[model samples]
Target chain A: EAGVAQSPRYKIIEKRQSVAFWCNPISGHATLYWYQQILGQGPKLLIQFQNNGVVDDSQLPKDRFSAERLKGVDSTLKIQPAKLEDSAVYLCASSPTGRGALAKNIQYFGAGTRLSVL
Target chain B: SQQGEEDPQALSIQEGENATMNCSYKTSINNLQWYRQNSGRGLVHLILIRSNEREKHSGRLRVTLDTSKKSSSLLITASRAADTASYFCATDAARGSNYKLTFGKGTLLTVNP
Candidate 1:
């Protein structure tokens, strides 16, 4: 029963540089998500995947941001030409099911990668 | 776009007192959930109340949902210093597009021992 795992707890990059973050979700979890949480603000959903298929990514910045869950167990989110506005915490979360039908079905989050673009 | 907004952006209270946080959403929802996050940490799920349910309790935590008003409240009884954290309310709208959760700005609560 391990929790969701993420790599590079903190990252610092310069504007216009590229950065990538990785996430390994809980075992047997079928859904994974990537969210951006700016300082003093709530998390904004960037993308979602259900069993290697994208469920939603309407809010993602297609020009600069992209994510993929190739094998359905792990995911990676990338941002190219990072801007100052992209300096926020990137959180990775996983859910047991895609429907969220269970009464206690909650999205378990990883420690998150804090990106500081200078 | 953010779906939920929490009130009283920040609060400070002494230990053994009660702490209440409110959240309001703009659209209909299938369920609402509350989560707590310590500084520089990931969020931890606290409670979830479905649309058909009015109230739910877990130990010292009590949650009340009013669909007519599109609002929800979280009450922590006999709060302690350990309860100091940012509390966020997330909504899963009824539209059923994989049931994504939309979060709010959150309420920062500080408890003094």
Candidate 2:
């Protein structure tokens, strides 16, 4: 089985610029997630989607970050007017289950897009 | 906003030895999972232990969860150089009908061949 796929393995942008990352989850997976991993820190959940609807995005910075999963199969996370603090690896992940209780589900992750904002 | 906190931020050991990593969480969880991230790569799911499960084993990996203490530990037996990577523990917390996972900073493990 193929793993979660993300585009543009690495990216570099200037402060105040805009950047976007794409993610294509595993086949038949119903849940998709986007996370940010700053250097030396764990990946922080940015947003989560179940099917074509958002499940949670409380941690996402509404002023600068946004994400969408239009068709429920693929997702895109965007950050506008990026800041130096936004320099981190953006990881995309997926799981097999949908809503309701989370049991023993494990998430599969992509190689991630490393963004370097100068 | 991080739930899990891993111990011994960094560790170095020789091959064939045992490597143990511990994680503690702040709130209640439905399950705990471990993931491995190689340099410049995304995370890979290593194992998952439900709150009801005290221990689980897969291959050379063993995970123990103590809900009373809100702590968990991962043991890699006969570690290999290939095991060198950053290990993170994630807690699956339920919010109403939805769920979210909070990951820790991670433990950087170095194994010498």
Candidate 3:
């Protein structure tokens, strides 16, 4: 099967500009997630979706960041008025579900979109 | 907040040698996982060890988890140049609505041939 797919392997944008990244998860996967990985740091979860419903988004910057998984297969994460701090790699991952030992929390990641804020 | 923190931000090893990386977490966790990422690439799941288990092995990879100390270690035996990559430890904490993995800063390993 194909792996999770992310668009625009790299992106360069000016501060205060808006940018968006797209993710297409593995087929039949029920859960999707968006994470921000700053240089030299681990990935920070921005939002998670179980199908079309959001499971968690507590770490997301509500004032500037937003994400949606409309059909439960593909998702998009957007940042408006991007700041220098937004310069990081955006990673997308997916799993079959979030329960049981068979498929509880094994996440497969994409190549990620590296964003640069100038 | 991040759940796992890996030690030795960077490590260099020669082929045929064993490479070990450590990770420590703050809170209780259900499971811990290891992933490897090539330069400018996505993360690939290496292994997952549940809280009830102490050790697991997959091919040349061995993982040991100590819940009492809240620490884990990954050992790659007979390392190869292809093993050069960043390894990260992720933990599935008990808190929150669902199982979300909190990753560590990662350990960059360079295996020279």
Candidate 4:
């Protein structure tokens, strides 16, 4: 099976500029997630989606970041007026829903987009 | 302050040696998972041990969970240069949908050839 896919492996933009990252999860996976990994740290959850509905986004920076999974398949995460602190790797992951606890939480991750803010 | 905290922030060893990394969490969890991330890449799931499980093994990886102590350890035996990477432990809370995984700062292992 194909793994989760993310585009624009690396991106660089000036602060206050806008950038967007795209993700295509594995086929038939109903749950999608976005995470940010700063250098020297583990990935941090940004938002989670159960199909087209959001399950959790508590850690998302609402003011500058937004994400949508309108079709409940492919998703996009955007950051406007990006800041220097936004320089990090953006990872997308997915998993099958409604399965057993063991299977449900087995997330498959994409290679991630490396973002650099100047 | 963080849910998961890994010890020995970094580990370096020669190939063919065993590498052990420890992680400690603060809350009760339904399960704990270990993952490896190569530099400049995403994380790859290694293994998962449920609260009821004390130990699990997959190929060269072994994970042991101690619920009473809220801690876990990952042992990689006969390490290879390819084993060099950052290892992380993630904890799944006992509550909610079990979709969220609280992760630690991670331990960087460098297996020299």
Candidate of highest lDDT = 1
Cα displacement (angstroms), candidate 3, residue A79, comes to: 0.6
Q: What would the per-residue lDDT of candidate 2 be over residues A14-71, giving only the tens digit for each residue?
A: 9999999999999888889999999999999999899999988889999999999998
- In terms of DockQ, the best-performing candidate is 3
lDDT of each: 0.94, 0.92, 0.93, 0.93
Instruction: Give candidate 3 regions above 4 Å deviation.
Output: B95-97
Q: How big is the positional error of residue A46 in model 3, measured in Å on the Cα after superposition? A: 0.4
In candidate 2, chain A reaches a TM of 0.94
- Between candidates 2 and 4, the one scoring higher on TM-score is 4
Clashes of 3: 0
**If scored against the real structure, what TM-score would every candidate get?**
0.97, 0.96, 0.97, 0.98
Clashing pairs in 2: none
lDDT by residue for model 4 over A25-114, one digit each (tens)? Answer: 999999999999999988899999999999999999999999999989999999998999999999999988667768888889999999
Query: Over the full model, what C-alpha lDDT does candidate 1 score relative to the true structure?
Result: 0.94
Cα error, candidate 3, residue B45 (Å): 0.4
**Model 2 regions lying over 4 Å from their true place:** A98-104, B94-97
Cα lDDT of model 2 by residue, B3-50, tens digit: 999998999999999999999998888889999999999999898898
Error of 2 at A61 (Å): 0.6
Q: Please state the Cα-based DockQ of model 3 relative to the true two-chain complex.
A: 0.90
Q: What is the C-alpha RMSD of each candidate to the true structure, in Å?
A: 1.4, 1.7, 1.2, 1.0
What is model 3's interface RMSD? 0.8
Assign candidate 2 its CAPRI class. Answer: medium
Scored on chain A only, each candidate's TM-score is 0.94, 0.94, 0.96, 0.98
> Which residue pairs in candidate 3 collide?
none
DockQ of each: 0.74, 0.79, 0.90, 0.74
